[model samples]
Target: MKRIAVVGASLAGVRAAQELRAQGYDGGIVLIGSEAHLPYDRPPLSKAFLAGTVSAASLELLDAGDLASLALDFRLGVRATAVEPAARRVLLSDGGSVHADGVVIATGGRARTVPGWSGVHTLRTVDDALALRAALVPGVRVVVIGAGFIGAEVASTCRSLGLDVTVLEALDAPMAPVLGPALAAVCARLHLDHGTDLRCGVSVTAVGPAGVHLADGSLVPADVVVAGIGMTPATEWLAGSGLTVSVGVCVDTGLVTSLPNVVAVGDVARYGGRRHEHWTNASEQAPVAVANLLAGRTSRTYSPSGYVWSDQYSGRLQLAGHPSPADTFSVVDGELSSSSFAAVWQRNGETVGVFALNNAKLFNRLRRPLRRPAVV
Candidate 1:
């Protein structure tokens, strides 16, 4: 390929570009991004950055020298309208087009927002964090909708700043689908222990100036509201692009879309019937996708690492492997009520998942077995 266009300057896209260069592909790379700023780390946006503990510059994924080495035709602040796989061209919103031999669709998802609610804020970008940070002040009653990782992190940051925080979850338990009821209860306790008024199994009807309106006619008064429900995959631009997009841009194990020349990665890619929005998943899929894209077919299959970590309250939460409610959970070290512990989920007799809180060493040791690939 003479040139490759990588859509979305996200972690996955940046990694894809780097992988191409590393693999001795000395071709033209057009890194397209909708954001004006260079690709930056997004994990800190809801925590340290929102809490004013980290600067914007510290979040950059690449330095000036590193970026210069990649030899990228950086197209920042422009949205990709559509892709023509057969013609090998990407249509841009600026009335321009990027014609390349290959295309990488890494357009990650955007944070879900509440419509018709001007007062509600959703944290996804640097601008979103900055806007929310400015609104957060002393004694502001902050009500966070959704008790997922992002919502919990936002509430934890707010509480750290000495703000009154209350988190609402539509489900019976936060992260129940992944953590299951047993471990999910531990997550719920973590919020309560940190002095957060966490309410589960609640339905939110509307968001007005007064506060959040519930279906049962109860109002949760708040001076500031943040919606951390989830993210919607940014696949609107690929509507007529001939790629199978179901919730996300559907791809096979090789991260190759329906078109041989096109591939996807990160939160926007639904690989092997599952889409992981984790940082590790995004970074790991790039190499495989780049390989398959260059090979023009499925040469290597992508396997999920199933690793995710979060910082909230006093401990660092970590999980590895695919854990479901059906799996049996047993604590290996320390107690669940304690500040530090490591646990594993078992299916029949085989261990399927591992979880830890402030116990990195043990967790890392236990994670190795799960990382081993199965013999076909």
Candidate 2:
């Protein structure tokens, strides 16, 4: 009970160490991460950092001085190979072992790389942003291979530099899966309005030195391409760990795995209480996991309510709650393409999900005091 080891070394791991210290724990804390760099915010790698407006040095989660004061040993560039529950230790790929009273898995996720698109780059870290930012020059022809949050922001960054940008989406519309088909159309229109050549429902048949060849035999000429097709959780190392492993590391409300003294967090954690693919969930889960681990208890509970937000040019998007299976929705405010608006998703006469697009004030107003009733 005098020492704890936290794996994954991203937002969740960093927060977990901080929370343990805050919970009045005076023990040896170790944060293990596969990345050589310390925990850094991943969102801006596609936006501000790609536009050359932000620097990597500003993205660090904990400074060296903070690390020193916290008395935390950061095991950077170390990949955890296995979880030895019986021994209360972590086996690392680099032939090392970390013994601890508790372990937290905050391994985060990985960006899905596109094959045959050697010209395309995916942004998920400081290095990715730096490499992509180096190509952001005025009048450079660029093609973004998806129109999700990362792709949209990359296009935004390119547009700022007066680059000839084209966004190709295989889906009928961008952000439709999350924002609905109608509102996603609004986002499409915004891209076109800002001089982005958005081509949806088209697949990249080939990627090579010349340009991207389309399935319809059309060629889109570009000097560079960027793909942002989302990510897969970094939990493959736990393949033999004997815990639940779907697309993510399955965890419960207490953030516990079936394995004893172990918890998972961040995007890599699929909490059984609810979905947790959001920063808000990470903000909530880390402290809870740390508290339970420090207290040496097994019955503490915490729920992961999936919520995340995005900014596209002048527009702001906020998802406040989880959507229900039988959810029907109505736009309680402005039109999809117009000014401030909100979409209220309801299930059996109760609000289940709330989304505000360009409606910051209303979003803030409803950000608190709303909870989803458990589904039967």
Candidate 3:
């Protein structure tokens, strides 16, 4: 490939560009981004950044020195209008086009929002975090919708700021879709112990300037409303591109799309009918996507063992590998009551995943074992 275009310019896009250079591909690299600022980490936006413990400049993935060394044609604050596969060119919102031998789609995703709720807020970028943080002063009545990772972290940060924080969830327990009811129930205790008003198994009818109205006719008073519900892939621009897009851009095992010399990565790429919306997945997929692009075949297949972590209170909760609802879980070390422990998840008498709380050493050790094939 003589020239390459990488869309999104986030972690995956930047990493793909770096890998292409590291592999001795001295082609012209163009990194296009929708956001105005340089690529930054999103994980910290809901935690340290929102808490004011970290500065905005600290989130950047590439510094001046790093950008200078990469020699990338960085295009910031521009959107990709469409992809012309036959022409092998990308249409931009500014009536411009980029002709390249290969293209990497890493547009990532945007925060899902509630309709007609102009009074609420959602965090998906550094700018969003800054705006939300400004409203999170002490004594502010904050109502956070959805008890997922984003919601939990926002609630934790709000509590630290002495804000009256309340978390609402439609499910019976927090993160039940990923951790199951039993584990989610245990995790929900973290918010309760930290002085958060966590209400589960409740539906929100509407959200106005006044507060959150529940289906039961109860209202949760709030000075500020934050929505951490979920996110949808930024794939609207791909409409009529002749690519199979469901919840995200559909890709094969090699992360290659239906279009020739084109591949998708990060939260935007849905492989094997699954979307792994975590940092580790994006970092791992970028290199493989780069390899496939250069080799002109499925030289590598992306398989994630699944790793995710959350910060709540003084505890660091981590999970590795795929833990399904049918998996059997048992305490391997420490105690849940004491807030420091490790749990092993097994399927058909074979280890498949591990969950740890404030136990990094054990968590790291168990991760490798989960990657091995199940012993029948």
Candidate 4:
């Protein structure tokens, strides 16, 4: 029987397998994951799970029964050493090789850790978040490095737990590069309103075992320090695998790799015409590769429109289409003081994206038209 080896066992890989079976490819599907735990929801890891509102068991993306019913051969805690595309196989770290008619590299990305602050922790995986959660006890002073999405969410979760939290962002604003200054400032304020001491434009030149040491030479003491620096895709083991492994394993519009019978997806994939690290994009991109692999249906293509959102305070910030710095801008609504309504971002007279704050109705109304953009 033909075999499909999905490396990375993350959202992209897991979704790929589920879609493959749904599309009727029941051969032999093996899921390779470095983490010992079964795939679970990463987004919630910083939210409800960390807040103690949701149990770790409930954070599971798939239960044992679901995996058993799918009948997938899960290779958890095993890493793929190399992918021999010509040979249509993947060599594992354990010296075992899995022959594959097609391979999906969805290894995802790892959270980038900061130097010093050796005592600091990050939240990327279940284990990472679990350890971080333990340090977020009530009344404990938690110093968080980096105010990115993960950091912001961690800060939000900590605040919800009635813990004293302080966030340090090296950038001028939280999500500075992504949301631009205008909206990013509002995000920073939201954190501050929620009892989080957000320090923007602050660089952590060196973190100490005691806490985070700032560029200004002030020592921020805390019971524990959680770093949300960032993440790098898991592609070290894929080096020289005859695949374009730059920042991410580059894939084409169809999510196909340079080598035949091999493809990549998720955070590890730089797919479409450009790289999209968003999870929804990963989920949408995986099926295209899966369809080509099992059913011999290879006509599908993928266009990357990066869309990512965040739940900060009482708002839901959603972005559809890619809006660049030079892109045109217009606000449909900006009633953020009440934390409701939406903001429309335009580029070249086209609606490139819409960011909403507790405005799902407006978000939905803007999505279809935005997704179906036409050159006028």
Candidate 5:
């Protein structure tokens, strides 16, 4: 392939371009991004960046030296409207098209916001974070809807700023499905322990300049409201593009789409019926996807590490492997109530998942078994 077009200049796209160069493919690369800013780290957007501890420049993934070495044709602030697989052309929003030998779709996703709500915040991009950060003044009342990872992090940051914060969750136990009941309860306590008004199993009816209106007709007065519900994969542009798209652009185990010359990655890709929004998943899929794309077929199947981490309050929570509510939970070290512990979920005799809160050392040790490659 003489030229390859990588859509979405975020983590997955940048990594794919880097992988191409690392694999000795010194061909032309066109890296396209919807956002005007350079590709930057996103995990920090909800944590340190929101807390004012990190600078905007510090979040950048590639510096001038790195960009020069990669020799990428960087196209910033442009959106991919459609893909013509047969012609190997990508239609952009700016009335232009990029014709390449191979195309990589890594458009990630966009934050979901409440309808009929104006001026309410939803954190996804750097621009969204900046707007929310400006609204999060000291002594302001912050109401964060949804108790998922992002909502919890926003509440934690608000508390850190000495602002009045409240977190609302539709589920009785936040993240119960992912972390299981035993561990999720531990997350609940962390909020209360930090003086956050966390209400569970509540339904929000509406949000406005006044505050968040509950299903019970009660209003949680707030100067700032942030909806951390979830994100919708940015696949609207790929409509009628001849690629299978459902929740996201559907791809096979090798990250190859319906078209052999095109592949999807990151949050925009629903691989093997699952879409992972984790940084590790996006980073890990790039090399394998690039390899398969260059080979003109599925030469390598992508193996997920199932690793994800979150920073909340004053603790670091880490998980490896898939942990479901049905799995048998066991506390291997420390206690969950103490804010520092290591635990595991097992099915029969095999360790299926591992979790740690503020206990990275033990977490790493326990995660070793999960990271081992299975024998053929």
Candidate 6:
């Protein structure tokens, strides 16, 4: 391949380009991004960036010297409007086209917004984080919608800044869908212990400039509201492109799309019928996607080493492997009261997952074993 066009200049796209060069492909590399800024880390946007502990420059994944060394044709602030699979070209919003032998789609996703919510905010970009941070001054009333990873982090950051925080969730417990109700209850208590006013099993009817209106006709007074409900794949540009896109761009085990000479990675690529929205997943898939682009059918197949972590109130929670709702969980080491422990999830007498709280050492040790097909 003489040239490769990589759509989305985020982590996955940047890693793919790096791997392509590392694999000895000295072709013309074009890294296209919708955002004006060069590729920057997204995980820190909620924590360090919002807290003003990290600057925008520190979020950059590649510096000027490194970018210059790569000799990449970096196209920032341009959106890829469409992909012509047959012609092997990407159409940009600026009325330009990039022709390449192969294309990598890593557009990722954006936070889902609630309709008619004028004052409510969602954090998914650097700009979003900065705006939210400005509103999170001391003594402000902050209401965070949803109790998922992003929501919890936002609440924690708000509390750290001496703001009064409240979290609203439709489910009975935080992260009930992922950790199940039993363990999710433990996570719920974590927030309550930290002075978070958590209201579960409640529905928000509407959000206005005044505050969040509940189903029971009660309004939670909020100076600033943040929504971390969820995210939707940024795939609108792929319409009529002959690519199968459900919740995200459908890709096979090898990360190959339905269209020819094209593959996708990161939060935008739905591999094995599921889109993993974790940073590690993107890092893992990049090398595999690049290999397939260079080696065609001879490339390695992708197998997800399921892993995710969250930070809240000086404690860290980590999980490895996949745990279904039907899986049985058991505390194998430590205790929840101690705030440091390891738990294992089993299904059909086989270990399927492992979780740790404030136990990074044990979490790292158990990751490999949890990833095994059969762990006794």
The top-ranked prediction according to lDDT is 1
Positional deviation of 262 in candidate 4, in angstroms?
A: 0.6
Candidate 6 per-residue C-alpha lDDT over 101-199 given as tens digits, one digit per residue, 9 for 90 to 100: 899999999999878887888999998998998888777899999999999999888888888999999999999888887678878888898999999
Candidate 6 minimal-lDDT segment of 10 residues? 367-376
Instruction: For candidate 3, write residues 42-103 as lDDT tens digits.
Output: 89998999999999899999988888878999888999989877787888888898887899
lDDT of 1 at 21: 93
Name the lDDT value of residue 150 in candidate 3. 88
Model 6, position 20, has a per-residue lDDT of 89
- Clash pairs detected, candidate 3: none
Instruction: Estimate every model's Cα lDDT from 0 to 1.
Output: 0.92, 0.79, 0.88, 0.78, 0.90, 0.88
Candidate 5 lDDT over 27-68, as tens digits, reads 999999999999999999999999889999999999988989
The segments of candidate 6 whose C-alpha lies over 4 angstroms from its true place after superposition are 372-376
**Model 2 TM-score on a 0 to 1 scale:** 0.91
TM-score of 1: 0.98
User: Residue 307 of candidate 3: its Cα lDDT?
Assistant: 88
TM-score of 6: 0.96
Q: Each model's TM-score?
A: 0.98, 0.91, 0.97, 0.93, 0.98, 0.96
Candidate 5 residue pairs in backbone clash: none
Error of 6 at 147 (Å): 0.5
Residue-level lDDT of model 1, residues 132-151, one tens digit each, is: 99999998999999999999
How does model 3 score by TM-score? 0.97
> Candidate 5's error at 322, in angstroms?
1.0
Model 6 residue 219 CA deviation (Å) reads: 0.2
Question: Clash pairs of candidate 1?
Answer: none
